[model samples]
Target: MAVQEMKLREKSAPARVRVVVEEAAPPMMPVIYRRLSAESLRQALRKMLLIRRFEESAEDAYMRGLVHGTMHLSIGQEASAVGICAALDPTDYMTSTHRGHGHCIAKGAQVSRMFAEFFGKEDGYCRGRGGSMHIADVSTGNLGANGIVGGGIPIAVGVALSMKRQKRSSVVVSFFGDGANNEGAFHEALNMASIWKLPVIFVCENNGYGMSTSSDRSTAVKDVAQRASAYAMAGRIVDGNDFAEVAQAAFDAVERARQGGGPSLIESKTYRIRGHSRSDRNRYRTKEEIEAWLARDPIGAFERQLLRLGFITTADIDAIRADVEREIEEAIAFAKASPAPSIEELTRYVYSD
Candidate 1:
């Protein structure tokens, strides 16, 4: 990292308060683009930093015996969730999976409350009712994170259906992993979305493996995007590690959906550096595979691209890192300081909060 990038990470959150004065917007790419101005690039980079910091923090806490349950970190694949989310409006809906921390942050979820929920506090998104696998912020249009793989796809279809019925212009983005493509629910949901021409962008994040099983062994399709043809929808494969590609793909899909062009599938070919879960030994794959993916670290790659393009200084990235670290620390403090839901409060929301 350059000196300027270092400074950027150090002053992360404080810089966000300033207004971005855009003299002229950069050219938009229908397929892929990383041509963001310095300020916009900084903001996007900060979000990726935030997600990386947040998940790593949660993992550290889990190891230290702070978090009580399972925690799936979305550390390596931050670009897939964050960049796509940047293309969305607050009114648009998205459904998440077990590895949902990145999704939550991308959907504008409150970081402090998310931490509170992780700590089982009363102020959590689910008010402490839902734990790690069930975080939900309805206000942000993040339908609760599903515990079951591929479970949220159909639900997102339904959400999109409602948007269609109401003519709301809002589209539902359904994010599932490569593992989900093998599931029956994924196929069923795609079928329905295809038949109805519902505005749903099915983003299959092909992170190479489905738990312990390699996607190569799990499915015959070279790319999950090819399956969209069977569903009668347009499909495209993208470099998921590239934020520009991700943002462009999402923007194209979102605009098409808004224009009532129905569903599309985007296969974001990326990798998850961590194990399937916190407990994963990660020995199922070879060291070379891990090292290869690490070489293409999405956040680091984007940061380099931004710097080379003169869009970000090293100071910007460093300031972002520090602010993200502090934010995570503050979240930890908030979660620890907040009270656990009272036994009395448990029955409260069950009836009426």
Candidate 2:
């Protein structure tokens, strides 16, 4: 009887439960990492590097009196240009601001032809007519860079309207600065686009200033993206220096627009390390702020991210740098050797052919 009772007690004992906690699957990579091929990412890094080197070279040239007239340099906003353009099709159109070298290059303009334009040579996209601030490569679908603040916004809206009427799948990306956000054209264009459900993307490269004036002093809204609500469109704010973030936002907006989802606004919160223009003394901001932003160099940050993701090796980066350097040197040589437009032919393109 006692043996039976002991057996029953043993049988009643609770069974040990084994807890198997499978290590949580590594956090899902971002949309860009999953969507873009390795080659595409490498190309992105290459373009970022190229923009940096090109801007630096342009600055040096301006200082040496090789380039005439005042120019705005997109020295620190490389990622915003590259990331946004990466999401665009070759057939799509783009409008640029005065600070638009990066945009031109990102949209597939050749550095040689661009250099020729800067040199005012006949080989330029504008046949030596439009220089730095007005470089336009129609073959690459770049309408033109606007010297007037907020000028491109209305143009983009019009282009979008045209596309809608034609039933074409192409979209237009209008890139402007923080200052342009306050302009009347900005409001008018967005309202019209939203009402028509036009395929357009309004990208505000908000680099903390509209010329020498800080945006906080000039603008009412805390974030430029907040303005999109008035137009009943999507608005997103991203770290413009982070390529992945900018690209992801652009990709979403582009896809949405392509699907007839109407227009979207992306306010890239970036900082321009350089002054407003070649002549800006940069008295409005402190040296410490500039230094801090310099530390977040978009090219360097993107390079590091690429390395971490194993998309690029040190050797590859070195090779890309060498190649871009050689390319720039060749471009400079080509520009110097190209012929300038003669005075007799200066007014050739002023009228319709």
Candidate 3:
């Protein structure tokens, strides 16, 4: 446990410590969240690390010919996924983007099952019907990962609508990139959610680019949060790479929605560490830009935060990384021995009775 730790650098005072456990819990804008217990913090960090390792291994598996279809990596975007996930209860639903492995892990989906699903095995969560792009664990309140841009946004709004109509307190969150913000569905969903005062939070992970296009090149407005005002909802612009800040902001919005305060838009200004997909040459972005974001890597940043806050020992972190790597390796093994879904079963799940 003897390890030199890092310190928590304050970018801004965090919103207050009002964390609601259920969908109906009240909301508050705390300056900063009440410091989570070491166990709580550790669990969140472990999940994030697990996500990082799982994604890295998945990428390797795809390269090794074990997993088919497109695979998205959430390597550098761990905190944005994990921290917000920490703010919610298991009953709260979530919708994920194409690069949604981090969301899967953070939302408590089983790693082995996810891998099996990706490998198209019968034991997989979706029974091999949904592959990398369509992973879902209903037990964890994950609706599913949508392949289409802005596709899940409307779905999340529907879930929130259902929650309100049924007198359910659960809030639903939709995680997407800035590219999704420009979609017509995004505007439509936001308008409805605002009008209905639906318990939904639109989480925009502005990772600088949509596929290969940079944000500035594609987006006319500098801030996606600015769009929130059009809907008359709260707009929170935050550093997505900062785990604490992201978690705090999300907690506030989710709580607000739970208590009938309505929807909020959180623009998490972060970056992607990998190319848009496995085959991306990354020619659209400069090497220096990637390097700059890497310098502030979310995983490394959080690890340092734990160390500085004396929340975790070097031994603890080492154990965490080692365990994550081991779990990922196990997932790969499970995936390798698995068989692909049969060609004869293509018509199943295409329609529900």
Candidate 4:
């Protein structure tokens, strides 16, 4: 009976064995798309649009003598501002540079109040005391915009240390320019932040030229992010014009910091299409250079990306533009209608109450 069973088994095609292999899982989504919703992305685009339009309107207002004092217009670097801020929670804190109107708007400041600040009205974020360079909205977690280069870096370090002491899960972002990278404060702040493992993100908005002195002419290192090694921290560089790229880098750094992984140095390679300040004649650069940067406009690049991704249509862009225009008009009207800080109380906000 055993011999007969063996012969029967052998006759059944030798009992062939099959091996199964599973295919690899589909690639994970891009960081921005994975972490942020479609609505968040749309709001990002809207914020970028808001920054661009607001800057243009502010320039017009400045030209028409409606605004006083020189203002640093961020004209072409909207993506760097809005993209980085998109990764932040409303509770997270940030400090800005002189070129910070974009930062203010990206952090959820009302354009009407921003315009009011620009107009030096009483309803402004600083109650007209800060003006264009000193806009601060503590309620929105914006520490303030620093007129001094690299000034915010140390401030951010202190804030981060405070958060650590209190055991808060918040992080502080210090937004500076390429010019600030050379400052002594920057190195000291980075070193301290790294040693203490503080949650601070040092964002260098390297817009090629630091007030007409090209970074190539000023910075010893090819890229500012390379400086991270000195402080033993993570360093990354992204095309500051590409909103998606900027958002991804910022999100990764933010997450790392929030999780107690320490600080990061992100160098955003962007260009400012406008002169450094209102008084700049732009003679330090050429028309061709300006045109090249303008062609690579951050807002336009982001808009194109949104349209291609089906996040927004041309009509959506048009409607957003219209909505922003109305908002700007309304902001200007509000500023014009708002009262100015009284002369008798000129020192009202000078000291902490």
Candidate 5:
């Protein structure tokens, strides 16, 4: 009876103690600002703010029926554009996606001309022939922003080829979305770039969704950087929200390409705070998901970092904001005052022959 009682007591005792496995802390990213000058940091902040304000204003213009046709805004993905472009030399070339205003702005295109182009004015790039999705500034090495998904990949490869043939030291950077990775052009361009060892950097802005479809449903690979393996090139994943991280990856990739190390792929995991287009109601995502991303706003986070690092003060930030606001307002005024393209010049730029 005593033995039976002891057996029962043992059975009633708690099972083996459970041990929780703690996850390791992520490694620290390099301090990019330490290597950059104060002027560079200020410029980055200014450019990022300018892109945000410009996008906000553009949205308002679209709603007011001032901008015609469809428009894609990179409101939340400014860090990826600015960070990567800032890592490049002034003479380096870059191709942008439909959501490319930020890329143009980061690469030093005049805001007045960008607004003028949207307004369809004669003084605008492309003389108002190209709308929001087609802005290009050859003088600044901005090849142009493509409307078709994955359209700019091959164009960037072609530019790289031209540079290679000319024996130029310049490199080309191609920016595209997660959706573009599924396209055939992406595969073709990467393959050719690989075989020829073209001086190009293929940047994939994996913003979680391609239109309304989540990347989880569309892409087979969890990380777009894995695609580089198929091409036998180097690839990396970066925190697109962290400007320092993106800039570091871009710097390494740009340096590699410049040194004839061939092409590299960088997948920047980011999110779009705004809808895919003006007409989108964003019903596909939940408020909770959006709020989570909003908490990680690149501009706000960077501002805090700058303050904490003593790189800038609240007053400095405010001054930068005021300056950017004034500049954007002047750009809008210039666009408003500029005249539309003349009817006689309609067919002038239509044909190559």
Candidate 6:
């Protein structure tokens, strides 16, 4: 009987396999023509390209020993900066992280002046006093980029409080990294903003690493968005490499804040192709990991999407690249030619002056 049972079990027909077909994820860009106009798409592409070029130029200058201080380049995170800024009104306020040149550019700052600032010229923003990490443009509504980790979060909340007190419809967007999420200021600011119903959007650009430490090692929560639940605010995770995804999420968050819906946390999953800063040798990450992300280059992927949608031709993309290159060269020339800050003006803008 045992032999017979074993034979039956061996001869039994293979169990029926069930294959579940999961629904495909949504496209990076909206399919409806009316939802995203060709002009707007083109502008997004241009803005992203400009940022990439500007960062490349800055990196080159730094390598040549032209720049005195260190700079944090947002080489692989252009989509996050451009997409979020594109969703904002010109009058809307934004606070930036140390890696904020892209934020300044997306917020309508001129590359010439930015270059001048990096070169420490008198014509630069902040009159050349604030270098790469501290560039600010009040006219463009950028409060300033903070050098301290998690420093800008509180400042953004304060700005939102001020806006609320004034009854202004504008919202504030705060850009910070995954590392900042672990800071005491992050929790305090978010709690206060939530309790007060401040009009603020806390955007976490989770680029996988905080300096040499991986976020997995530092953050208690797997997804930064999960923290929003503690504060009873809306939280969303987005593909930071996709411009359309980031833009859509940003639009909704901005609208919510403007309508007094209080703060929303957006965690954009992006990667920094470059090291944390110019001084980093990139010994922390594997070469294979870097190659994998480089293949998902946001700008290249977006260009392909634009071509496929017939919004732009190869020629159009080439022309845009050429124009941006020319602009970058001109900015470099302008920065080099600009005079340094005068000794007489050294103490001029200081508070004690």
Model 5 over residues 255-279: C-alpha lDDT tens digits?
9999999999999989988889878
- Model 1: per-residue Cα lDDT over 2-69, one tens digit each: 12222123343332111111121343333344444567668888888888777767777787887887
- In model 2, residue pairs whose N, Cα or C atoms come closer than 3 Å (at least 3 residues apart or on different chains), thus clashing, are none
TM-score of each: 0.89, 0.91, 0.89, 0.90, 0.91, 0.90
Predictions in order: lDDT = 0.83, 0.86, 0.82, 0.85, 0.86, 0.86
Q: Looking at model 4, which ten-residue stretch has the lowest summed lDDT?
A: 1-10
Write one digit per residue (lDDT tens) for candidate 6, span 92-197: 9999999999899989998999999999998888778899999888899998888999999999999999999999998999999999999999999999999999
Using TM-score as the measure, which candidate wins? 2
RMSD of 1: 6.0
Task: Please state every model's RMSD to the true fold in angstroms.
Answer: 6.0, 15.6, 8.3, 17.0, 13.0, 12.4
lDDT of 4 at 8: 9
Per-residue C-alpha lDDT of model 4 across residues 1-74, encoded as one tens digit per residue:
11111110112123221112122233334557867887888889889878877887798899898888989989
lDDT of 3 at 318: 74
10 residues in a row with least lDDT, candidate 1: 15-24
Regions of model 6 farther than 4 Å from truth? 1-33
**Candidate with more favorable, higher TM-score: 3 or 6:** 6
Q: Which residue runs does candidate 2 get wrong by more than 4 Å?
A: 1-28
Q: Evaluate model 5: give its lDDT.
A: 0.86
Worst 10 residues of 2 by lDDT: 1-10
Candidate 2 lDDT tens digits, 1-353:
11110110012222121111122233445678788998999999888878877777777778888888988888779999999999999999999999989999999999988888988899988888889999888898899999999999999999999998999999999999999999999999999999999999999999999998889999999999999999999999999988899999999999999999999999998988778987888889998788667666777767667776688898888788778888888988998899999999867877888
